[model samples]
Target: MDIFSNHKRLFLLVILLFGTLTVFVAIFPALNNQYSYEPLPDSIPLTEIEQRGKMVYIGNGCVACHTQQVRNVEIDKVWGSRPNVAADYAGIERTNFWVNTATLMGTERTGPDLTNIGKRQPSEDWHLTHLYQPRAVVENSVMAPYPWLFELKDSIKITEKDKIVNLPARYIKDKSKKVVATEDAIALVAYLKSLQQVKLPDGTPSPEFLYKREQKKHGANESGGSSALDGAELYTNYCASCHQTDGKGVSGAFPPLDGSAIVQGIDPTSMVNIIMYGYNAREEYGEMPAIGQINDLSLEELVALMNHERTSWSNDAPEVSLEEINKILEELKKQNENQ
Candidate 1:
């Protein structure tokens, strides 16, 4: 009671207690984590361009809508292969001496997590177009366009080396003007592309996702058994982001599977190979990433995905069987080994 009556003494005591609590509860643990954790063996530092792009990402408030972390939950499986660990972020350094929002794990995911976006969508053209106008690629997207990151030129100059983006007729007010991504946009795309999950060293067991939910089959085909994965669900998760639900991909950006010759071809070899190895049709459309290889999709998944593409969007084609896909995979593996 006497000490409480002494104002100076009370203030000093409160300050000391607060400091002690902060040190023991907050500072000490943070320091320990900083010192003990090391980046994964496969982790690579960002290039100078990527660093600049990271700053642009910060300045544009991308963290407000997108998350960088993939939580340890079954639902988060689409974002990453495994749960995030402290080591995942150990390589990240401060943006600068005065600003240190490098570990931008984000509070909530308004958009999808960007933890593995580089691996997920590696097409620079797609990203550039998306940034120019989100709705250009993704219909009904709520993201605002960053038109400032591009320049609309009547014609590309002979000296101009900047890559040009071919937008949809509706999006481009003037057909004569070519949309060019500025240095900032290029840097930002580079940064986004750098946001890949670093693989753990060989023999290191990856963290498991908890609370795994039992997935139901997408229904059996004539040849597929009940064990067949739901191709529709897989497509929705992986393909729907670029190829719309209607199978009509963004014009001039993503090629449509609705009437694609590859999707409706008599032979499934080309389609399967494209899904596994990815396709680059830069002159016609944005490059497609190797979704199958990145996700390590199983035979059932491959069959389902192929069947869905073949049967969907009024495109009639022969559905692939697991046996066929497995044979193709074997051939691909041998080819890779030989290469």
Candidate 2:
């Protein structure tokens, strides 16, 4: 008993417990700073159907595959809006939700990012068909069909003779004797419609509007001596390899010249500047090599080429002049020297 009493095991155990508690208290705030719970909108409120669908989204583990955040580089390179900011989530009231706490913020993207999914494809019927069978629309999509999200009813009698309605497939019974969407698919569609991309900044011109104006101007000069046909041929030889024949581009590698506001905008000066001097290294996509160094095209040739690209395919930018090109080149030289 006297030998045991001389030991100090209790003192050592107390010191260890205190040290562990102290460390945890110090680090807890930093660890929990990643996610913030916010309330949804009240004006265009989420309906009971949408709420049920959200529950299904969580239960099905959709977040395991998709991420919502878009970084700054991602926005510029992918033609997406600016990176997500905390102000975007400022209005939501705090409440307990089924959040993925392991990553604190969210998981890595396994599929296409869903941040602006609602805006990307805005058709409800398209989403319904895609959910029922993805291969029906996107040939390369890997997402599994979520048939269980739909309410299944068999032999629903056709009511209106004039209306052509597609019926859901026959329902299958589970071990519990419950009928489900041949896979239960509609709930997931509701959830997808709720996920909208963030709004763009004010004063940003839509590609469609810009293209229409370009077309109107081009149509006016159709009977004139202008020749976009020659421009088109030149583009095929010089530009098609990097910009692609369609003009949509290779995503993150080549910036889309077609439907680009800068290409179709009122300023022909900017267009000449970009073509003559090449873009600076600060561009989101890698710097375009200085093709102007080749010195192959004369002033008129460059004008024809620019007109062809701006008005080719669905583009409609106004025709540029040789005078405009010379002015832009002079300005570009000055800017280069200043750099």
Candidate 3:
């Protein structure tokens, strides 16, 4: 009888120990470190209004839809950068006086990630416009508008005795007389302003590189540039299936080259180099096959096509020279010979 009682007690102790170990080792790591947060370097300090906005974000469950991490290989090919690290969350410690810090160190990404949202679109006015109505900006944006966040007041009224009553309808809703501009809305905007990606000192691209390619074509007026036309035709034939006809590209795979800063803003030399030699870097998507071999496009023709794609559609990139294409071809020949 005594031996059986001891065995039962031992079994209970083992189960408790196993459960505790699982909680600490398996569950904690999965929740806390799956997608670590990393703050950007030289980030602007958040104002009091921004801190208040963060509380609104927490209250409204914005984190439920958007994640703050971006993985390197599988995910970054679509997102354009690597996943965040723990260092990203360091800024939260500086701002919050409360115990529940504004650190989003979660794993699941139910919607588009917000890891580098600040850099993605820098204009506060744009953010305001977007919040007012996402479809107004991005035709396909899934986000819903938070209209209660703004302040809507009636006209200011002053009395001769310095006592004001019955403010004008301009200060309130015309039909209901309800004033808007809730504190939660202001706080939410502040939180969004804080969500900027940190840049490495030398790794950050120039502001020129950040401009959308479609904006670059406003200066050139010549229409019959055959090279660009040829390139557009080639792109439509060879690249459109994966990159999409419009060049917006499928999310999480091919990136948008129409407005891509990388394709249009980088040195023309680099663009030719990528086309001729093809890229096999693990950083990008599956190696862009060396289509230069199968296509047999002349150096001039290739340059024309490249420039066309750079400037055509919504892109506005400058034209590429044949000399640049020749140099790229010569380099590719040398690389092939070495291989």
Candidate 4:
């Protein structure tokens, strides 16, 4: 009763209890050296340019649209080879002892998770193009373009340091104007390229779980083979990341293959050329990469892909043989020589 009434004693007791808790629960754990029994990993750190790019990423509020974290769940499978862990972010160092600004693990996912985007899409051209005009690459992408991060070339002599963008003729209708990437754009891309999942620190629990699963997947693919895979399945694996499943395209970014005259055209020469050499600005679309040559797709695979595209939806184009496709390609080469 006396203690309850004593204000000084109560204050002392509260201070003593809280102080002890602060030391034991917080300070002691931080000081306990055994906690670091696992050695510091040899994971690569981001370059100085990459760090600047990170600032650009932060400045542009990229985190608002994209998430850095990949949660441990079934739906997050497309994000990374494995579920994310603390080690994935261990490379981020503190700004000072008191401040840590690098904790970019976002709260929402307006866009896709960026947990392993650096590895999944390593094309600098694709990223820069996407940044310049999201819809150009992604069709109906809702992302706002960061056009300010680029400069329009107006018949100026291009220098060695100048980073020119390969846009479609339609996009740069004024022949005098050519788009060049700026430093901020380069830095931001460098930063996005740096947002990769690091190898798990040695001795972490189930460290190899995800990697083993990936190896097994590859092994199965190697045995079953790309040939055994149907065109639809192949599209799902490769093209779906860009062209999408429905083939309606990204709206303004990817051109719709479902109803494309190119796919269903009587002459398959242009289609074969597109597959081999890719294409540039037809209208609003930016550039279609030569994915066929890059992936070393077989003639059989090309035939299947074209067949699938031509026959899908309401399209009813007659199939052309491989021999016909080769002959057409050869004829096109001859025409080019005459020109």
lDDT digits (tens) for residues 64-98 of candidate 1: 99998888989999898788898999988886799
Ranking according to lDDT, highest score first: 1, 4, 3, 2
Top TM-score model: 1
- Model 3 scores a TM of 0.45
**Local error of candidate 2 at 338, Å?**
56
RMSD of 3: 15.9
Which candidate, 2 or 4, has the higher TM-score?
4
Q: RMSD to the native, candidate 2?
A: 16.9
CA RMSD of each candidate after superposition: 2.8, 16.9, 15.9, 8.6
TM-score of candidate 4 against the unseen true structure:
0.60
Q: Compared with the true structure, what per-residue lDDT tens digits does model 3 show for residues 1-339?
A: 464579888788889999999999999985675456445567666688887776677667778787776654353433324445556565565343546655664566665666665534333434554565554445577888766666444435322322111222332246343233355654565567567566554775422223223322223324323422356556754465445678775443345677877678757666666665555563333345444543445675576668767886788887766666577678768887999
User: By summed lDDT, which 10 consecutive residues of candidate 1 come out lowest?
Assistant: 217-226
Candidate 4 lDDT (Cα, 0 to 1): 0.70
Put down candidate 4 lDDT per residue, 174-210, tens digits, no spaces.
6887788999999988888666665565665543233
Clashing pairs in 1: none
TM-score of each: 0.87, 0.42, 0.45, 0.60
Give candidate 4 misplaced runs (Cα > 4 Å): 1-42, 96-99, 168-175, 198-339
Candidate 1: where are CA atoms >4 Å away? 1-11, 158-160, 199-211, 218-220, 224-226, 330-339
Whole-model Cα lDDT per candidate?
A: 0.85, 0.54, 0.57, 0.70
